[model samples]
Target: MEILPRPFDAQPLDGTSTVPKHVQLRESLRSYIVRSGEPGAAIPSERLLGEYFGVARMTVRQAVDCLVAEEVLERVVGLGTFVARAKVDLHMKMTSYTEEMIRRGMVPDARVLSFEQQGASPLVARELQIEIGQPVVRFRRQLLADGEPMSVDENFIPAHRVVGILDDPPPTSLYSVLSEKYGLVMEWGEDTIEATAASPSIARLLNVEMNAPLLKIQRHAYVARAMIDYSVSYYRADRYKLWVPLQRPGVRSPRAYSSKRLG
Candidate 1:
């Protein structure tokens, strides 16, 4: 059986418009992909698109190049371009990776890469709020979702807080162990997120190309006034995206304002 290419269902390009043809084609392609609602699906070839839109193949290529650069489409050597996988949206919240993965219906796994006690460096000391030379438990793990590599996490905790952590088996969820065994329930947390390129070591652990874009998150988790956990995590930007909610402050409803005026 032969598989025919899906039809593109966007409005025809306006040849007389002042807007650039590539830009118009790019938007039309974007809209068509959204309406199709399929990930990893192959898009029409440049020749076919050029013929349908009455444009040069080079124009079609330029529009496709823009989408490829934005990661909206990916090209394989022997295969044609495809719609990229939808990135997982990470809502800003105080939740463990395991819990978040479960909420997203993915099986979560963690492979412990390194675990040992180490003297706190200046930066580690400042982040964990411990003495410069104080002992700390340092552990690095490669986090996964459905057996696929997702992120690499390196954690630091005051040795005095988790005294026997090094002796025990590495836990899948550190927060769970802390609350169950040590009575250190996390009350609040602060995360600093930034865009960064993956280093060689991190790229190896996360199974991504070196210098690929990553979301670097530095977290400080607290129990009451004491910081209990500090971790630096690098997430693959191709697989994950940050989602933040926004709201305007001090807005009043028109009905409420009218009632207040009458009162």
Candidate 2:
């Protein structure tokens, strides 16, 4: 990995500036990363940065900490901080993980952690629009892309939706199985995303540090008008991002309406 060169000739932090010193330092570091650093390149030590900028070591640390939280930098215990790799952006669309990875030219895989039939709790029942304590097939799996752990998915489906799903092993993409085997096509889905901290088990599974940032996604999938499954997936925040396209309300594309309508 190429080591990022320090910007020794940069102007010192202005004392009269209203912005906090740490924020100024952070912006400088961010620019340096963009211009000079590559993924895994080591950043300058806090002590060295402090001396270079004539600031307290704590101030340097604070700036570095913010970058770490943003995943622009990562710190190894024995090694110093280094630039982070780019994250994968998942556009807001109704697609299976397998399909998405393939679209990105990545090979996708899944390891089934556990699979069982159980009585649904109130939350699961409500999400699947079934009676409380109804029979449900619970499937837990870990998703990987190019052999790197990506996310953990836990899904609950009403027992009647896909009969004999539990008889065989779970596939990497549940949607594919539902479509091919049961003829139950997932036509649409709704998702909610939030930032969260990794749990101990999640950290271990994903090979990340405990309490590291994670992206939590909750989804409800439907076939026609019937709810089919409810799922929650925890994705590594440093490795993944959610993206969506927005359009102003009351705006319509020219193709959406015929030109004859104007006449």
Specify the highest-TM-score model's number.
Answer: 1
Question: How would you encode candidate 1's per-residue C-alpha lDDT over 120-172 as one tens digit per residue?
Answer: 99999999888898998888999999888999999898989987877789888
* Cand. 1 Cα-lDDT: 0.88
> For residues 1-263, could you state the per-residue lDDT of candidate 2 as single tens digits?
43325544444678799999999999988887887788878887887788888899999999999999999998888888999987899786778899999999999998999899999999898888889999999999989998999999999989988788888877768888998999988889899899999999999988889998999999998888888889999999878878876667999756557765866
Candidate 1 pairs with clashing backbones: none
TM-score of each: 0.73, 0.71
Which regions of candidate 2 are displaced past 4 Å? 1-38, 41-79, 252-263
* Model 2 steric clash pairs: none
Give per-residue lDDT, candidate 2, residue 263: 61
Task: Report backbone clashes per prediction.
Answer: 0, 0
